[model samples]
Each structure stands twice: as structure tokens, then as C-alpha cells.
Target: MNEAPNRNRPAREVIAGDRRYVWHPFTQHGTEGEPTVIARAKAATLFDADGTEILDLVSSWWTCTHGHAHPKLNAALAKQAAEFEHVMFAGFTHAPAVDLAERLVRLLPGDLSRVFFSDDGSTSVEVALKIAYQYWINRGEPRRTLLLAFDGGYHGDTLGAMSVGRGSQMFKPFRDLMCQVLVLPYPATFEGDDAVEEREAGALSAFQALLAERGQSIAAMIIEPLLQGAGGMRVCRPSFLKRLVETAQAFGVIVIFDEVMTGFGRTGTLFALEQADVVPDLVCLSKGLTAGYMPMAVTVAREAIFEAFLGESFDRALPHGHSFTANPLACAVACASLDLFEEEKTLERIQAINLRHRELLAELQRRSDVTRPRVLGSIVAFDVKDIGAYQSDESRKLKAWYLAHGLNIRPLGSTLYLMPPYCITDEEMSRAYAGLIEGLDSLKR
Candidate 1:
């Protein structure tokens, strides 16, 4: 039986199908409101069914670096598809994959020269963890099996990724299944904070104490770098990061940076590491790798780490790989996106966004209802006066308020944030900030 085709379906019709068969992530269907059916999107603006416009202030969950449906990205995909769609990446090599890898190696900081392509952010982190763990085994130090992570850092959802991010309290149900990991204190700083130095010192001390205790046993230390994304936009100073890395490497621990959310010009630079002036032994990058056009991530390793895996026996090689590893289409689009970084002058755009965020923060400082105002590159975040942790009732109110005003902003508990696509205009940023001020004032009244 031939049913109605999907191409020209209405909003209600699409949502009806979704309710019957689709299971969304991090959502509750019984009590939650119906999901907005986004029919079309472009340049930081999303239109639902009936073409109602909504400004995407959260960059559609902090992706879409260049914006939605950028014509250059679309053209790149179409051109690649005409040649070929996908090819299994084992033993075989393609121009797109090789070229993208080469470009990433040159672009990334430090000696991260080897790239292992994966399907998404979670798997990219998983690859980095696995490589770090096995790197010790291949080098005859299996005793160094423990992983290190930062408290309040959320990496991804996979078992290994969840293990490192367990301190974020997002993976409580899977605690029994995940392997052991050492979590250090994260010194979360904000604007007009007087005790930031004390917090930084205490956190550094905690890292030192932990490293001293497990110095020889830790396989690797993975951090979210300068800005911890899923941790309520908790930002740390770059000097803190530099000192932290120096301390970890001194303990003979391999360092890994999970740049899943902060990479590709999110943090006022081409990469967040560039700001910290630090280079990790391993780094996982995704999200904006293809300007959010496709799901692709890479675990880049130092040349020395890659060399350690070379051996005659298959036992010494890294056995981990995804089925869609180095898909030709993703690689081609990623290359195109990287080119747009220069063509569109994305870093300059981000600087302008940062300047605007600073101006907004100045306005936010006058309000008693707002607290912990912080800005990093294209991201700006602040907390409401008296809301609880992640998944609080008050945060839901904040979210509904934004939605009512035709904005897409999903807050982390009390912390409302904006990570607008770089293509968003100055006027749009001002509107988003003004709406936020109005929302907070309404709550206060």
C-alpha cells in the first residue's frame, strides 16, 4: 500500500509520525511538550511548520558554525555525491579523506599529526580513550590503566566517554558499568568574581595531590579545555589550563583535550588550544568540523603516540574503527567548511560576536536576577537568581519563556546561554540579549 509521500507533509502530519515511532534523546514524552517540527532552516534562522521563524541562539545545540543550509556547504556535498557517496575506509584511501586529514594536522596546535576518523563526537572521544589505554599496554605498562577527567565536564554518552564524564552526574544509571576514572576539581570562573584566584589555586592543588597519588598508574588525563560545554558553560582561565597541562605531563600522564563543542572558532580562535598556548598529546574534534552539515569527528594523536602502535603483531595495533570511518562525503564537506573559515573570515566574525557579548554582559551586570555572566568567543552565558541544578523546574520556565518569544535556547539548569551561529547578525544578537533581559525581569516581577 502506497501512503502519502514525505516530501510535502504538513507539520501536524510529520509530528504525528514522530510521536508514533521516534524516540528523542534526553526527553520525556509523557509530560514533555510536543517537539517543534522544523520544516526549513537558513543562516541562524529556523522555520517550523507554517513557516514561523525562530532565532537559533543555541546554534541548534552548539553546532551549525557557519549557519544552517549554507549554499557552499550544500554545493560541496552535491558535487561529492555526484562522484561517489561513501566507501568503506579499511585498507582503501580516498582524496577527500586524505586531504581533510592533512589539513587538520596542519591546522591543529602542537604535534598532533595522526588522525583517526570516526562518526561523531562521542565515538571520537571513545577512540581517544581507547588509544590512550592501549598505548600503555603496547609499550609494556599495563599497570597504568586508570583514566583522568575533570569534574563537571561532560564528554559524551558512550560507556567509555560517559566514564570520564561521570562526575557531571549525567551518567548515574550507567555508573556500575563504566570503568574507574579519576576526576579533578574544575575551577569555574565568571565576571566580577573576587575569589577566582582562590578557586584556581585550590583546583590546581587538588590536581597536584591526585597526580602525586596516582602519578604512575594514570593512563591519560582528558579535559574539556578552557570551556566546559555541558557543565553549565563553566569557563576557566587559559593560564589555569596551561599550568594544569604542564602538571599532568610532568606526572608522565598522556593529555587529551575533548574539543567536541569548543573547536573550530568557537572560543575566539581557530581552536581553543591556541588560546591556552597548550598542546595535548591527543585531541578529539567535531561539531563544526563540517560546519554542522554532517556527523564526523577525529581523534588526532601525536606522532610519537602513533609510532608506538606500529608493530609486526596485530595485537599492538589500535583495533578500534567505525563503519563510516572517513566517509568521502563528510571529508569533502569538511574540507569545504575549512575553506569557508578563510573565505567568510569566520574568526573575525567571532571577534565581533565576542565584542557584542561583552557589551551585553555589561548590561547584565546591573541586574540582581542575573549572576555568573561569562563570555567566550561566540558563547555568552549567565544564571538566573535562584534555580537549582540540571533539570530544574525553574529552568523549564526559562526555556518556555524563550520559546514563547520565538527563540531556540535550551538552558542547562539555571544557566541560560547563547552560542549563535557565526552567520548571525549584530541585530539578531542584540535581540537575543534583549529578550533574555526581558525574561529575567519578568521572572523577578
Candidate 2:
């Protein structure tokens, strides 16, 4: 079990030793061990120690929006490191943090102005949940204890996030410790799905009934905006989201959009809320927030919501603060990443990916092994026939097959999805889609 960490060690050796010490997220280590060790990464490609170029079709877990180690972001991180790495965000403020917050507020919809910082997606979600929960409590409504979330919604793994994401089924072990979050059916639709209206009506009716019953006690309702990423990339209609927002607002429920996986031009727009025309009371952002250069998360809320916590008493203030909150290095990289969105024309590239996704989705439907074909922005996904479920033997075999083909495509249950970086070339994307077709064909009879 003594694997050397140098340029000479084999990739397999490093990978094998990783099993002995490292524990991966969302993985059962008892059965799944020796995870692949990526030595280096560039735009749309990861290189193992042995130098196998693995195509990153999932954007490195849906974070690297502009691509891996983007030059601008790298430079930003280096510059910030020389100046200041991190400082306690409680009483101190930095240029990168303040500038990034201002930039983000300008880009987001409506007057969502107050930005609270954290370290990752889960904490961002936790911040939003806590803020909303306490906002009502501070306003003399401590009884508003209930939270609302969609059936397939996934926020994060923290306790507060876990409560809202109870429907995701990834928290079975800690189920007893988690709080209650009311689940409403997610009315998902894909290309050429004509029954969407009926499904939306059913969902709306369910939500209306829930609001009619427990709407007063509800603190907030957190959503994935347009596409629910971890919940099998389930996509909801924009009109349905608008109606839901209106209904929640009418009932005085704080609407929160968990844009952790959908923010920063991943959905062919700056944010998914741009397409829906609905402003949320709070928005959770992370993942691509720093364009994969650093880990940072933000919970942006409306001014009035922030005002609710503005009393001289410490009890009225939100009791959340991370040591690396508003980290200068992360903020600097995020600002650079934002620049790439303009200078590099990232939106145009994403639009091209959207076109390619549509074309590939149509071709994917022609295959006999794919089912439930769906496309949202640059993301295209379908269920493979043989892969039964997330923890099934067949699922592991399918994932291994993709790895053997030098593609890092992390599947969700039987669902095979692609969310390549915005910098992915047409040739690379074509190769990935072709690999998916081949993987599907291999699983066939």
C-alpha cells in the first residue's frame, strides 16, 4: 500500500493507494475503491498520471463552466495569492470580495443585493435556508417552521440543505436527524412532450393544496430553477416555474432558486431565472461561480430580507460565518471568470453547444438502448436500458466501460448525461456523444 506520489508512479498505483486513504463523495467505499487519479486537467480533458487523456463530459461534476485551469482564472488566483489568500469575513472586507459581490448583484435578476459568502454549494444552500428560516423567525413568526421543495429537487448535503433535499433520497442514513420538508411533485418535460400542460396542472394543484393547508407555516420553498441536476437532470417548464413563484409569493413564502449547478451560463443564459422571468427572494450560487479555479459559494438575498436581520441585538443577526468566507483568491478568480464570459464569448459557445445537444439528442433517440431523451441548454441525457439503478452491478459496469474508453462521464443511476465545458470543441463533443452511443450499443443484448 506504499504508493509514491511523484512523476514516476503509475496511475493505477496512485489510484489503488487512494482506496486505502481517500474517501470519495457520494460513493460507497466498501464496494467502490481505487478511484481514478487525475494528474492534470485542461480545457475539456483530464490527464491521468500515465497520460491517458480522459474527456471530461460532465464538466468535472458540473463546475468547470469556462473549462479547467482557464488562463485568466489561473492568473487571477496567482495574483491574489501574492496579495492575500483569505481573511475572516466577519469584520473585514477586501477588494475582490466587494467587487465580485457588486458584479454578481448586477448580473442577477431583480434587486437581490445582499451577498453572504460560504465555501461550497452545500453551505450556500445552508445559508439561504438558515437566512429564510430566521428571517421569518425574526419578523415575529417563529411558527413558520415548514420548508417546501420539489420531488426531484437536490440542494446539497448539509443538514439544512438535506432537509430541503429530502426527496433526493441520498440522506437515508441521517434521515432521523433531518428536519421535515414538504415535497411537491416535479412536473418534468422534454423535447416533444405534449402532456407537459396536464402534468404542470397536476403539480400546480398539489402545490396549491399544500399552500392552502400549510402555506402559513412554510418558511421557504427552494427549487433548482430550471434543471434539477443531481435529481436526474429533470427539467421543468418556465411557465410552470413562473406560476409557482407567483403562487408562493401570494402565500408569503420565500422563493429560493438553488442555482448551484445551473448558474453562470451553464444553461445558455447567465442564469436559468433569466429564461423564466421570475425573481426569487433568494438565490444559491456556486459550482461554476469561480469557473473551477477555486471553491466559493454565495447566498444572495433581497434587501428587505437582509433588513429583517438589522437590529442591535446579536440574536437578530444571522449566525453563520466560514473562515474562508469571501476568500480573496476565490473572489479574484471569480472576477476573472466573469471577464471570460465577455472577452471569450462564452455565451456564444454555450449556444453552439445547445445546438449540438439538440442534434445529438435527436440522434440518441434513434438508438434502441436510450430512453427518456431530454435536453436542457448544453445538457443532454437519457437512461440506458441495461443500467438498472445507482448502486446496481450493471451501473458500475457501465461506468467502467466509459472509463475504459477514456471518458469521465459520471452517470446518475441509469441516466447518462453530458455537461461538457463551454470551451469544448465540436470534435470533442462529437467524440463524447459517439462514445455514449457506443457505450449504449455495448450494453445492448
Candidate 3:
């Protein structure tokens, strides 16, 4: 087909084409620079077409679990592709999908036994929201119309996901189109913050009062357990999550844990819910599901919720399906990625990362420019003092500084954070931290 459109085009030509045609996500193309052209990646390093090796610190947007081009994951994808690429998932069932479902059922907590495959994190959340809304209708209680979400919790970019994540400040243009959601205060905490207990108590009190006022009319209460990713890497205590779940359960409110970012060993556990010792009615999982190799997500539901959607009439069934719902390649890669968790002792790696994070954050804490240092599992974040806004000058400067130093890091507003891949070596991590220190030092200048 026309020589496959020149497989070996120059990097400049590719960048020119992108400038002409590409519309990047959450990007202001008018003001932003050219996108970095990554030609290849290995382990935790990405190589640009110009032969520059960039250390991946954000896990390529918090997706790469076992790192880029992992041998085992690559082999799994190759084996599946050799057999079959893809088939419509509506009526067709494949071994890879079934095996993934079985493994997820075993790995997930509580009664999250039913897995509904979707394309990405947003769709997984959309599926969960739809299920939650329809479950009450199937149960003959269609009055549960309101949805609740914690402030600063971001689910995804889709409409339904955006509706719950409205407070995340990315959906202002589509605010009128979004459904009304009751937003609760988030008890975000940091190291050496003595007021955390007070904040937690105040948040709980507010939630309890809200439940007392409008618990019956609520359909579901969704949150990003432990860590809120896009909302600036804000972390809460596991005890707060447990208490929140208990309060929601007491009010007969369905709880949804949007574990899209915190799942699959990122949180030093299989899932964030496990650390909290809480079981949610529905959970949205993606991002690291396929170790960032393939686009896949699953909205896992409790058996009770699944049962509500089953009936004699087709009207009662949850009507949702994507053409590539459980793509064979994605399923195979996800299964392989999950296998890596056990074989490679991924949780232990995450724990080690946490220790390093604490050490690095402690050093950063001494800097006057850094504030509110927080660590949860593999995530570590701190806010820059007196930064303007989300796309502040200081934030952009720091990002450019990191890239110039051969490190990849994207700051969320004033929040500078790192969510490195599990395969990152000690030296790589030290390099990343050194870059961070240099960037912070530049802020003083």
C-alpha cells in the first residue's frame, strides 16, 4: 500500500507531520513546543529519534508497570498476534480474555468477581457509572439519581468519567453538559502535617452530614483511593478510605474505587482498596493493566450488582459493548503483566521505591520552594510555593529543565511528582532525584 507510507521517515519530517495534523490530549498546541519523538524504549528509558536517552519518571503517564518493551510482555503479545490479532468481543469468547477474567477475579478483593472489559480507563469508569445508575433502576428504586465524588478526584476524560471528576478543572468547557455530582472534601495529607487528623475528622463530619441529608437519593460515591493522580498527586490515609467506605455502606450508597492509576502494584499492593482493607461495589482498573503495552481496562463489579442487571427481560441487562472489548493481544499482555507481578516481586520493588521516595522527599522538604511533601507507595509529590496556576511558568520551567537533563517528568500545576516504573534501577532513580534537586535549586535562582 504505497510502500507503507515510508516506514523510515526522518524524525523532523514526523514532527512536521505531527505539527500539521496531530491534536494532543490536554495540550495547548498554540503555545506548546514540539512533542518529543520517542523511537524506542527499553526497561525504563525512552530513546528519541535523535539518539537522546530520556529517563521515564512518570511511567509514561503512569501506565508502564514493568517498563517499556518488557521481554515477557513482548513475547506474550507476539504469541497472541501470531495466533490471532483481534475479533469482535460481542459473541466471541477467547482463551486470553477468559484467563484474564479468572485471574482478575482471584486477585481482586471481596465480591468483585464480574469483569466487564472496555477500551481504556475512561470507558471502564463509564461502564462502572452506568452499572451503578442502572443497578438502582433494576432494583425498582430509580430515585437514586444523584452521584457523589470526592473533590480533586479525576476518573478520566469521557463524559461519564468527567461528570464525576468535574472538580478536576479540565472539564470547564463541558460543565453545563455534565451531570450534577455532589462533591465532598478530600482529606489530602502530607508528611509532618499535624493537622491531617483534624482534616480527616472534618471531612468525615461533612460526609456524614451529607449522607444524613441526601444519602437515600445518592446512586454512588466514587473516589480515587489513596492517591488522586491528575488532581495533583494528592494522597489520603488508608484509614480515611476505610472510614469513608463504612460511612457510604451504612447509607446504602454504592462505593466505586477508581483504581485506574493506583492498581497493579503502584500502590505497593495489588490494589489500593486492599491497603485500605475495604471492598467497593465497583472498581475501575486500567493504566497499568497491560503494563502500558496495550489499551485495555475492566470495570469489575460485585456479584450483587451483576445479579441486579440479570433478568428474564433483555431490558434489565446492562447494554454495553465495544468492538475491541477484550482484544486478544491486550488480554494476553495483561495476563503476562499480572504474571510479572508475582514472578518479579513487583510489590517489593514498589516498597523499595516508597523508601527512596521518603528519602528524596525528606531532602526536598528542606528546600523553601518545596512544600507539602507526600509519599504513597511508588508516588511522591510536593508543591512549589507561590506557583501561579496549573500551567504556571515555574512548572513549565521545571519540565523543560528535567527534559534538558535527559529526564522525563510532567508537573501537575505546582505539584512536582514522580511515579517511576518498577524496573527503574537505583542509579536511574538517583539521577532522577538529582535532576529534581537541580530543578528546585534553579527555582531559588
Candidate 4:
């Protein structure tokens, strides 16, 4: 195979060529700034083509777990690539895929024993939705057509994902193409909020009321567990999740946990569901599944759910699969990534990061401009007051400021959040916090 002639081109020329052909995700090319050309990354820092070192505060969109260019992950990738990169996963199965599936089943909470592989977070959600829908159909209860999701919850950009996450307001143009999904008010909370319980009660009450009225029609309810990532980093109480799961399960509704963002120690645990102690009927996992090294996802379901689809005929089987389903290289990398979690004590690192976040966010909360400071595991987020929508001038200004200060921090509209890699040191975190304080102060000026 031959490589592109411009593979060795200068960064500026490469960027220029990219601008001419490539369209970036969630970016307005007409207004957004020039995309930075990243040369390499290691640990918690990204090196631009110009040799500028920028601290990765958002863990490269909250996917990176053990850090970039981890030796173990790299070795696993190289080893797998040298053996056989990929094979059609329809009838054929490989050791890497099988091993990964087994490991995931053992690691996940409750009786989540069956795994269906797909590509990326969106497809994982799509698979979960299909499984929930088909599981009901297999059980001769196809009337459960409605799917419930929380307000402001962002699953993904795919058609099915968009339908479930319709409240995110990112898919207005394609709204008509999506399936109808029921939305529930999320009991979003922050630091020092006294009305959290009241809000939780209200949400629970509303959810119970919905279940009472339309429980028989609802097929499943999907959630982002404790931390709603793209939904402005909204943090909810674990107790609320527990109650929500219990209520949904009682109504014979399948509970799907979209742990795409919260899995693999992001929420101070191996998975966010462990914090709530609630076992979801189906769990969608991606992002950190391969420690950000590969694009792979798995929707794990209960054994009983899997058993429902078992029949001799093709009609009975769940007819959903991707071309790269259970790619061997991705599976190999994911297994290695999971191994490092135990070898490197990744959960302990997350706990330390969580403690640092609380301390820094506490000080940030003192500023009148910063509101609704919240921290969970390695994540820290706060809202900026007086900033209009997600595409407001203030958000752009703050993003540029953070970039100028050697920090790769992206603000979600006015919601500034930090989710640095676990390899980040105390000093590095302090520098990020200091830059945040300076940036907030600059906004005042």
C-alpha cells in the first residue's frame, strides 16, 4: 500500500489542505478558529506542530484514561497489528474479541453477561436501544415502543442516539428524521446546593407519574448515570439513579446506562453504576474502553435478555452488526488498557484527581462569575454567569484564553469543565486551576 504524497508535508500546508477538504465535528468552519495541528502527545500533554506544550484538561474529549501513548497500550496495538488487524466478525471469532468480551462481563456490575460489539459511542447506544426494543419484541411485548431519556442528556449524533438525546438541541435540522422519545427532567445538582433533595424528589415524582401513565408503552430508559458529559457536565446524585432504576425495573422497563463517558474510572470508580449500586439491564460502554487508543464500543446486556433472542431461525436473532464489529486490534488494545487499570492502580489515581478537583473548584466557587461548581471523580465543571448560549461570544473568548495560556480546555457553551488524564500531576492540575482563575478574572476585565 502506498501512503498519501502529502504525508510528510509541513504542518501549515497540511492544515491548509485539511481546511480545503476536511469538515470537523461540532465546528462552524466559517467562524471557528484554525484547528491546531497536533504533532504528538504523551502523558497529559499535547505538543503542537510549533512545539507548544498544552496541558490536556479534557482528556482529549474525555476518552483518554491511562494517558496518550501509554507504553502498554502501544505495545498491545503493535502486537495485534503484526498478527492480524481485522476479520469479519459475523461467523468468525477471534481470541482478542472473545477475551475482551469475557473480561468485560466479569468486570461489569450485576448480571451483564452478554456483549455486542460496535463502533464508537453512538453505535453502542444504537445497539442498546435496538436490544431493548428487540428484547421486548422477542418476549411478545412489542407495544413497549417508547424510550425515555433525561432532559439535556447527550447520547450521540446518530439518528437513534439523536432521538433519545433530542433535548440536547444539537440536531434541530434532522429532528424530523429521529424517532419519538420521551424526555424527563434531570435532577442536575452542584456544590453547596441545599435544594438538591427537593429537585431529586420532583424528578422522581415526575418519572413515577410517567411510569404510572405510560409504563406499559415504555420499552426502555437510558441515562448517562452520575455525570452527564455533553449535557453541560451536569452531575446528578447516585441516589436519584438508584431510585430511577428501581422504579423503571418495577414497571418491566429495561434500564440502559450510557456509560460511554463515565466508564473506566472517570467517576472515581471502575464504572459510575458502581457508585449508585444499581444494575442496569443494558450498559453501553465506549470512549475509555480502549483507553482512547481505538474506536470500539460494547453494549452489555443481561443473560436473560440475551436468552430471549436465542432461536434457530434468523428472524429471532438480533439483526444488528457493524463491518468492524469486534475488530481484533481494538479488542487487543482494550484488554491491555483494562490490564493497566489494575497494574497502574488507575482507580486510586482517579480518587486523587477527584480530591484535587474539589479543592480547586471550591476556590473557583468563591468568584461571583463562576456558579454551580460540581466535581465527580476526575471531572470538575462550573457554569459561567452572564454567558448566553453555547455559541456565545463569552465561550469563544474563554476558550481562546485557555489555549493562549498553554491549556487545552474547551468550554461547553458557558459550562467550563476539566477532565484531565490520570497521569496528570498535582502541579499540572494546579497550573490548570491557576489558568482557569486568571481566565475568569480576565473575563471581568
Q: Compute the lDDT of residue 33 as modeled in candidate 1.
A: 82
lDDT tens string, model 3, 343-430?
9999999999999998997788788878999988888899988565688887888788889889998889988899999999999999
Scanning candidate 2 in windows of ten residues, the lowest lDDT window is: 1-10
Q: Please, what are the lDDT tens digits per residue for candidate 2 over residues 1-445?
A: 2223346667776777786677688777777746777777888988776667889999888888888877778888999999978888877898999999999999987889999999999999999989999999899999998899988788888898988898888788888888888899999887778899999999999999999988889999999988999988888888999999999999999999999999998777889999999889999999999997788999999999999999999999998898889999999999999999999988898889989999988897787777888877778888778788777877777788899999988779888899998999989988998898787777764
Each model's lDDT: 0.90, 0.88, 0.91, 0.91
Instruction: Tell me the tens digit of each residue's lDDT in model 1 across 274-329.
Output: 88898899999989998888899999999999999998999999998888999888
- Candidate 1: residue 434 lDDT (0-100): 84
Q: Write the per-residue lDDT of candidate 4 for residues 251-345, one digit (tens) a residue.
A: 99999999999999898889999989988999999999999988999999999999999998878799999999999999999999989988999
The list of candidate 1 runs beyond 4 A from truth reads 1-6
For all predicted structures, in order, the TM-scores are 0.97, 0.97, 0.97, 0.97
- Best-to-worst order by lDDT is 4, 3, 1, 2
- The root-mean-square deviation over C-alpha atoms between each candidate and the true structure, in angstroms, is 2.8, 2.6, 2.7, 2.7
